[model samples]
Target: MTKRHQLALATALVAALALGASGCSDTKKGSAGGGAGGVNPAAANDGLTIGGTPAKGGTLTVLSNQDFAHLDPARNWVMPTMDFGTRLLYRTLVTFKAEPGKGGSELVPDLATDLGTPSNGGRTWTFTLKEGLKYEDGTAIKAADIKYNVERSFAPDLTGGPDYAAQYLAGTEGYKGPLQGKHLDSVKTPDDRTIVFELKRPVAEFSATTTLPTFAPVPQAQEKGPLYDARPFSSGPYKIESYDRDKKLVLVRNEHWDPKTDSVRKAYPDKFVVVMGLKGGQIDDRIIAGEGADASTVEWANMRPESAPKVLPKPEIKKRLLAESQGCTTMLNLNNSRAPFNDPKVREAMQYAVDKEAVVTAGGGPALTEVATSYLPPALAGGKQSDPLKIAPAGDPAKAKELLKAAGKEGLKVTFSVSTGDKGRAEAIQQGLARAGVEVVIDTVDPGAYYDVIGDLSTTPDMSLSGWCPDYPSGSTWLPFVFDGRTIKPKGNQGNNSQFRDDATMKRIDEINAMADAKEANQAWRDLDVAIMAKSPSVPLFLERKPLLVGPNIAGAFGHPVWVGQIDYATVGLKDPAKSQG
Candidate 1:
């Protein structure tokens, strides 16, 4: 929605905040719940997970309640966007290792021969493409095709895509886009294999930005602009065989892609299929029972809370569930732009009024979540658990009422906007605050459009349910988006949703951003995370462990938190469809 990144999209934290696109929901509808195996042996879910080697062949079905928000490589930035499902069809200059946890540090060459050679005081970066690259259509993948991928992202038509390269690349400042014929002189396609980028400044870690799927190469002839989502040309192991937008998508093997050239994906699944529009309970039940093709199905997010009670208890079901830390922090946005919340005392009172226990129960209890004391989750460096409120993990209503009286808002009425799927969560908050003399009017929207509505400052309720996923693996992703006033926007990846505007805090953020030293940066961000909680702009609710049910039919069922707990698409495959239990 705003400048930041797909990463800024949130990458649905770009359309991954803008990524903040669609989160906290996944595939669904069911009669009952419980996994086929039930006894999951997942270890932090990430730190100790071992899925054993997977066998090849059979279709891997991705069932979802909703459709991907964007597919244009440039426009798709949210965390839960179709990057995971469609990644096998595309290749970026640089990509993350297929590992389930902490993928940011696992940068590896995809199309590029190596990371990137920086010269001219790190202002210029160059990458040489690997030989024998070809699109699904059997055409040689040229460096110009890669260059076009970045250039078209700058087109005004391509709004919501990452502009980091456009903004930072030298000789391109004030360059609007390529639709009107203005091209970035800094990006040079010197040959069929070599691509060079001249930056506006000395950026030591520019290689990280290339890891984004937004940099995925596209052939100019197949470029569909706005309609690219219909079916993008493939450069990876799979190609879109048929696409029905929100309804269904089928991927067949891209015979032209040589497995020897790529190192990450095994390309085991001969076909990948996505069936959307099913409700949560429906999908969970099928997966749990290992019925029909459900054995091949997997959820994009977690098993819905509606199915939580039915699934979390069964010992056998726990075996197939993925309960890993996803570096995501779910928080209640206190819209300071509105009344009651505009008052700091009122915000703090509401924070105290929140019963973490009740909220966590509504969020499927500790089996799938851990109460977050600070906004920083343990997934990031220097993120230690600290309860600033110091009240019980449950909450302190008496203290809250006392604060309410202190603030002269003894009987405040605040409207909370939440997703329809999260109705229990809203009711939980309403009940918690009632004791503190606060009335919460529930406002529920469709889960798919939740962020868009919340981002609109004018229509946004006094309080809203939203979350942040680490774009990369750093506090820089959390602190800046949650507290940095400079990042606040009217719509699209609206960071600082609380409308918090404190000069001292903003200054501290500037200082933190400028700190080049790793230790100093980490400490500065840790300090900032603590300081933000002191303001109580928003309540840090919980850190999530994606308790998704992976069908026994699939061999690699580990959930990848980097993509908002979606399975690592490339690595997962069927164990043995022929010998599968259904």
Candidate 2:
């Protein structure tokens, strides 16, 4: 069966399970256990009690286990909560428009009044900003602000400065050297409301690029340095009021926001609060205890059949299993520059030794069928191609042994570096490799240090466990960022940790990049996938399943195509038991 069909079947099974489980609940119970009961009327006005009805002026507390290393959009990567700050505080010019067969919800224009078509041979793009736009501090947002923010992303001192930003604006007349820390010659603000960008080559994903938070316009007059980090000047519907590290983050409605007249709905909660550092078990306890209401992120493995069924009362706190389109495919990236892995047969043998299904199933959740045939996930809209890698049929231990013996690297001492925070996951992987006769040395480090070490490709351990969620919903985001040798550096680029180098793959990537049409571009992406898979530089493991638990009142809380964590905050409302079924 096709991978798409397989995903469809998986989704159907999960949905059916949810329906069956929820149907067994008692409807007449006034105070539904597990925080399903309607909010207290008096508490609604005070905004102090969880599960209270919507009030125009109360703090909505949220909890996150991780802390933001940097609030700057360019540096921030983790999502659901990280995005809360970005989406609430900053506004991007061109948002995604809803497109069919693209996996999830489509993108539409967010801040731009109207999106312009490419001109000057697909190199120049002109955007018209909406009139009367104002920043949170009441400064008029002009076209100049957009130009400055885009230029700032290429600044030398910034932690997450994008190399591609320079290339995108390379051909423009004014902003030429900023990417290289010289005078810019490419970006131009032609008028008060007009901003034009010139590119070195035709960029097909230019519109989608605008959705990036780094492109969000910041006031030119806003103070720089430490003050900028503490006090963020923003234009979105909500503004950060206060943040207490490890406790809570409070946000208040931007009074300047006009939901209906401003095109889209403003932030729903009068005040938004995010509770910090709650453990996975603590989150489940809170949900069952009827203390915390609204959404919380859960690790899929932690929410297994045995644990979840016991922790959560069967019918009240209903488990809404969401199959994330963006697969978090974990793999062991080999440093081919090193011995043993330098040989293709050795790498191929190692790939054959791995049981992808066993690893995936052990990780818990559903049995993943659409396993990684390549670097890109199979369900990704445009990434449907045959893997070029000659993988051993199912479980071929005999062939694996033969290949390893032929390479004369039968007993190689391989060290597998695993992150410390996720010890259960790390141990599972270590045990799996051991079964295949691979001498696995587990090098455990803290999550933060682990990421830092991996980022520096020169210091990368022989084989390191790594995973990726797409920056955007395309195979282009996956391949070039991870496998393309051009991006792999002594200090890694955004995603290329594998440090893979191949002339044939690079040639195919260039061909796909040159293809102008979207359909043609997608086909080229598939061809590139085939080339990368054959090398076995990295083994595709499993797609992560994000289980979101929401109250019945919360509607349209599923995943979107581009935006990772945005629920329709505007339309979501408290349902009245008098008018609706329990």
Using lDDT as the measure, the top candidate is 1
Off by over 4 Å in 2: 1-59, 97-105, 137-139, 161-163, 171-183, 260-266, 291-313, 320-326, 365-370, 383-394, 405-408, 421-437, 455-459, 491-494, 551-556, 561-582
lDDT of each: 0.69, 0.53
**Compared with the true structure, what per-residue lDDT tens digits does model 1 show for residues 1-582?**
432211101111111111111222321111011111222222224433324667777887887887777667777676656346336878888877777666534678888999899888667889999999999989999888777778887777777766666656777656666656567788899899999998776555466678776677887788777888667788889988898877998888999999889998788788888888888778888888877677777776456545554544454665677765666777888987657887888888877898877776565444444567777766554434555567666678999999889988888888888877667777888999998989989988876687778777667788887677766555766777777777777776466767777888889876665544445666777777778788888988766555567776777766665666667776878877553322
Q: Please, what is the TM-score per model?
A: 0.82, 0.77
CA displacement after TM-score superposition, residue 438 of candidate 1 (Å):
4.0
The C-alpha stretches of model 1 lying farther than 4 A from their native spots are 1-51, 103-105, 117-123, 170-176, 200-205, 291-293, 305-310, 338-346, 382-391, 398-413, 434-441, 445-453, 490-493, 514-523, 577-582
